[model samples]
Target: MPKKKKITPKQETALRCLQQNFDKRAELAPSSDDVHATISKSSPVDIDVDADELEKNIATLSINNGNTRIRYILCLDIEATFDGDKSFSHETHEVIELPCILADIKEGKIIDEFHTFVKPSLHPQLTNECIALTGITQVDVDNAPTFREAIQLLDGFMKKHSDKLHPPPQIGSPPPNGWPNLGPRNYVWVTDGHADIERFLCLRSCRINRVRLPAYISGGYIDMKLLFKTHFKERGFRRLPDMLAKWGLSFEGREHSGLQDARQVARIMLFMVQMEAVQLKCNRSIVMEMNLSFAARQL
Candidate 1:
């Protein structure tokens, strides 16, 4: 019998994804209706289209290199308090935990970190399921800042970092399946999945507080789930644990801790950069014009 040739890990995963026909949309649980609706706002865009010679005065679209290198990256993860244990209700869900990291893209390591627990105004007492699933305790929320205060703290961090970092490039479109290079700093939001972005894009946080949406998230965010899809063309996204396992990685911190999740995301990003697979950037962002009631909010 002939011995089979060895295949690379990326190639192997591709084979598995192709064989399994993973459903990218299926990553969300049925109770994820809020996330589903929030994510639905951004539609997939066509970078280029075939045109007929007969069509007149059509602008030519150039092909992009699909290279989306950036100088810096900001990773964010938010864990909210929900009414139900399993399902997060959009009407009642509030941002109870937010963890973020600022990292040097070239260095592939975190430079600073910010994390805080937020007190939910509407649903002050976290449901039993939320505590068990997220490993947050009543004391955690009891001593935490209000949602507004937490946002202020995050804004302070970003402001300090902005002064220290380089300016961003001119706002421009990214390659298909890539994030918009908003500035020279190459700042883009990163998350393990779409659910996090949904929470912001939906503007639920702003509406609950009756304030304008924060400018921090206005820059746009990268969904690792979509980024992975771009590379592997997989049907569905893998759970964070499964994704880590594939790369021989173990969860470094607690499962539901926002800080841990943010750190893990940074590590994953660093791995991608080190392996030369970090081309993907964010492709969608919150259409805040529709959500912010034309009121401008500072970062």
Candidate 2:
């Protein structure tokens, strides 16, 4: 047998942290009822879906992925304002709601969540069509944070979980499976589609607000839609509800509501990993090349 590799001090610390977290998962894991209650209390609108049904579906879909390499997944979704039917452009629209769920892939549970509504700088007033579609009222945006402030808060949230979010470097070669050993960097961002990062976060919001996009946010992401199509050998992009239906699961909360949508995406991810044994990886990315000196001058 090959000699065992020695763990460095840094790796030892990370291992200790992981062990402690796992030990406390029993205390940290919230019951399905508690989760539903929390969402209901936090959301502005009432959810009409049956809580028992939703819990049952989640329980049915939750399966252990013994082959999963990653430790965590960050499921993200955004709701934005738009023009009725004229056209679609990231530049024209604005992100109105930002939400994300952090999940422990092996345990198949959402450990934490973050959410906020963003007030549009350009289009301060909500279009009637946008209101009807997203169910976000003018009053909601009025009380929300600006895009810059929202991004800052998001960055802080990521920092708060830095150990999990940014894993330490691996000291040796990757495993024989041809997949890189992610070391402490053991998480990937998951989204229903690419628009959340490519169009909204990187292109529109950061540019309009004159904020430098966080490196982690732009690094890369797993496009769940693409993964589903590839893994199941399906064609074309499907909506979140449709995707959930594939697993006999109904969406739990208000459609298009950022937090609800994010949670649903997390559920789909769990199903894919647990039921289908899909290995999650970054399927899409955006290349952001910025001239820091010039950018600093402009700022």
Candidate 3:
């Protein structure tokens, strides 16, 4: 095994602050209703915690601040080929773009990114609708690696950042039963919705490409849309742009561009954590059976 990487002093301070806040929050509140109160009092800032400006300021804090303790959130968003129809099946679609933003939990900013365009074996040609919606051209996919190759590159990126990750389970240990049973993980994947992981990666891409979905990916992920809805107690938003509009923020780039979407999702997640003190956790996981069928569990 490789030696663990050393964390910077700033990172150490941020991790300590986060651990203290989480511990205090757990001690102060036994119910969800009192969480905000606990967070407000436990915040490192000495101002009105409810103020939006304060929350934004907290987001910029780099050195101030998990079991199953998260050090990073891997924000991923995929753009796939579509016929411009809502009734399309996952079986018929193929991921054309893969992008990820690795956000440091304590720093509240993206520390790194991984991106690639995937050439689909099933549908090598992009439909006009898909091209228009995603702005991904045929040349992009033609010049890109295959799904398997792209995933291999992604795995390498994750390994490069392994020092920031939580230790994996022992080789002989029983597979994780649930969130509580699972030991500490340094990071968790976050997506705008379950489709990216559930329908795209697990159900479609892996099966189509004869690739085994990495355990790190299939283990679980956070559905950011669901988290936001539950946290704000509002269900009015239907898409990422809508979510941004609610916060008086506009989408920064092309709507369906994978990297841009992932960045926006990271932004929203940071805002929720720094401003609202919402604890991010894995809310979804895949259960793979002997027969290879997948059952997505909502945790």
- Candidate maximizing TM-score: 3
Arranged by TM-score with the best first, the candidates are 3, 2, 1
Model 1 agreement with the true structure over 190-228: per-residue lDDT tens digits: 787766656642346656765434434544456776666
Instruction: Please write out the lDDT profile of model 3 over residues 19-67, one tens digit for every residue.
Output: 4543343243222122112222111211112212211222111111122
Query: What lDDT is obtained when candidate 2 is compared to the true structure?
Result: 0.62
| C-alpha lDDT values of all predictions | 0.55, 0.62, 0.64
Q: By the TM-score metric, which is better: model 1 or model 3?
A: 3
Per-residue C-alpha lDDT of model 2 across residues 1-299, encoded as one tens digit per residue: 12223555664454445435433532453433332222221112111221112111211111123343577888889988788866775556788988878888787667887777788988899899889988889988897777766765566557658777544321111123322323224677788878787677656766666554544444446788888888867776688878877755567679988777888888778767766668766666543333211111000
Give candidate 3 misplaced runs (Cα > 4 Å): 1-68, 168-182, 288-291
| Candidate 2 error regions (>4 Å) | 1-68, 168-184, 291-299
Candidate 3's displacement at residue 239, Å, is 1.6
Point out the higher-scoring one by TM-score: 2 or 3.
Answer: 3
Better of 1 and 2 by TM-score: 2
